[model samples]
Target: MKPILYVGNINYSSWSLRPYIALRWAGIDFDMVEVNLDQPGYGDYAIAEILAFNPAGKVPALRVGAAVIADSLAISEWASETGSSLYPQDPLARALVRSAVAEMHSGFAAVRRDLSMNIRRRCKAFGLPADTVRDIARLDALFAGHRKHAAEGPFLFGQRTVADAFFTPVATRFRTYGIELSADAQAYCDTLLADAAFLAWEQMVLAQPATGFSRANIDRLYT
Candidate 1:
């Protein structure tokens, strides 16, 4: 049976998008349950619905048979086990990929805080916090290094991997907020934006009405 993936709003759920993209890229068959994150009583309702399958009370949880896998990274790892092209074949390359993904999973608080993911909206550029600037520089460096080393393909590691999936939201954030990037970094972002799966997700996101969940502080960074 296909696994069930629980997701939140496509326009704002960055974590949920990771596994969804990974599974789609891997060509894995799966079902999805989209919880209305913008609805009234969403917190309680989402918690209740997710906890029934995953104790973590989070979206992006994958239910396979009787087992529930929580966390986006964990779900991606599980999906990789199904002969998915989520990881590189070389041990060293795989290690680097995992490192990039883990760093993205735990770090980048400043950028995430200042430039929240909102695919449905685009904003004008404005001065960013020092920390956010630093985060963007770091991301540019990461993308540059990967692009330099990749022998083929426009993706970070020569082919799409979990690392690319993890950073996909970052690309969207840069675009949405008009974050300045080095030419190479901008090229990478452009490639991701042009991806068929990413385009499909964007179409779905645009079709949904705005959830009225706006961050005033982040919004101020845009026009």
Candidate 2:
């Protein structure tokens, strides 16, 4: 059986996108099972099914044979350990990558609540709050720093690392929301948008037959 990941609608599940991006960056093969997250009782049975693999009852859980891994960061790390150098191999570089990933995981609550991942739709002024503004500024600063340090390639630390995976959704959010950014930041976003894996994953998300997503909302961001 192929390794499987249980996820919610790709149009809105930012957390799920993290690991999906990582797995793809690592070039690992996996399967996807989508749950209608907006539907009632979406998880009662889904939880049970996934708990047979991951007890957390969360979407974005990874099933690798009998080994169950839950949570995006954990799954990304697991993917790194299994096959690819998802994180930087050097100790110091690995530390920097992990720090960036942790910052991504722990911080940005404001940005998350303000700009929920709605890929199929867009919103204007975004109604973002003051706190979210502060957080966004901070994130931009962090990304700028990474870009300066990104000597090797377009990726955060010269190459694609777990840190890039951690922020992949944020990159998408920035694009979807029409958030204007600095040249460096915009360049990083371009790299992510240009990634074949990201594009493929996005195509998969957009192909879902769900309804209610508003293209108008999304267009306003770009306009």
Candidate 3:
């Protein structure tokens, strides 16, 4: 049987997008199960549904037969095992990619809290908190540094990799929040935003039921 990817609100769940993009980039076929997290009884009903498969009650859990992978980063790692495209083939390059992916998987608290991942809405933000500003600077530096070494392609490591998958949502956040990036970083952001798999996810958001949280609030969540 094909694996099933359990996800939450696609527009807001950066975690869900990571593995979804990675698998699609790797050309691995899998079915998706979207758990409703915006409706009433979210604590009782939605949480229960997620807990059916993931004790953490988080979205983007993967089910492959009897085994369940319960984290987006872990699921992306699974997709990378399929071929050399999801990660670089060279040892040093692969390690660098892993470090990039890991940073996205675990860090960037300010961006997550302030910007959120509201793909359906476009809004401008100004005079952001200090932490959020710092995060954006870090993003610019990271993207610029990666693009300099990206001799093979537009993607960070020259070709599509899990690092790109992990950063795609952040790219969207930058666009949605109107955060400016350096010329090099902005070029990389353009490449990520225009990716086919990323576009497919956006289309999916467009097609969700009216009740779905595919439509997000335009307002930023931070002070």
Candidate 4:
């Protein structure tokens, strides 16, 4: 089966990265189609074509044969079901992983807004809003709980899962924005940055033709 994923710029498109990482991590083969998000025709031209597969007219839509899947959660679920090891075989473990991935999909709105995902652009170090800070603290608590109860290897679940892929872009946002993270979270971020799949993705991102916006600071992320 041929799978095509419509995505945006790698340096900034967190949603695109979610399914991309999930597929790559799970060894699912797919083609990528990039859309110029900064252009004026994004909504009418780029998004309209995307809407043929995804009603939301958004990037990161997954096209599998005649079926179309929109939204990262849906796409990732499809990846898991098809050929990816996005979740665990164990029922309880799979449930735990799904819960974590769902929280990442729906929660952390403040962190997302305050610190946009810019893989290539390092921004001025800024503090988070009160609620976002609270959210980060909550994340730290969650990680700690995982470490205490469910931890096994470098990742939250000892093996890479959809949960890690979901948060991978958030880790990039924290790195780009220079958020002050706790030791556990920082360690987690380091593990993600060092992943071979993520490194390969970063190299592909660097190889893309330069877009004028943020061209000045794009190379810093790879080095």
In candidate 2, residue 67 scores what lDDT?
Answer: 73
lDDT of each: 0.83, 0.78, 0.84, 0.76
- The lDDT of model 4 is 0.76
Q: Which ten residues in a row are the worst by lDDT in model 1?
A: 212-221
lDDT of 2 by residue, 70-185 (tens): 78998998888876778766899889998989999998898886676776665455567799889888888888888876668998888889888888788888876778787888
* Per-model tally of clashing residue pairs: 0, 3, 1, 0
TM-score of 3: 0.91
The model with the greater lDDT, 3 or 4, is: 3
Between candidates 1 and 4, name the one with more favorable lDDT. Answer: 1
Better of 2 and 3 by lDDT: 3
Pairs that collide, model 1: none
What does candidate 4 score on TM?
0.86
Model 1: how far residue 153 lies from native, Å: 0.9
- Over the stretch 116-179, how does candidate 3's per-residue lDDT look in tens digits? 8878767787778999899989989999998866678999888888899999999999998888
For residues 1-223, write the lDDT of model 1, one tens digit per residue: 8899999878888989898888888888899888756544455544566667767667888889988888899888887888566887899989999999999999999888888888877876667779988999999999987887556889998888998888999999999987788888999999888998889889888887766563234444565
Kindly list the per-residue Cα lDDT of model 4 for residues 69-166, writing each as its tens digit.
87787888788778756776799988998888888888988777666777766765544469878877877766656664335688877788888888
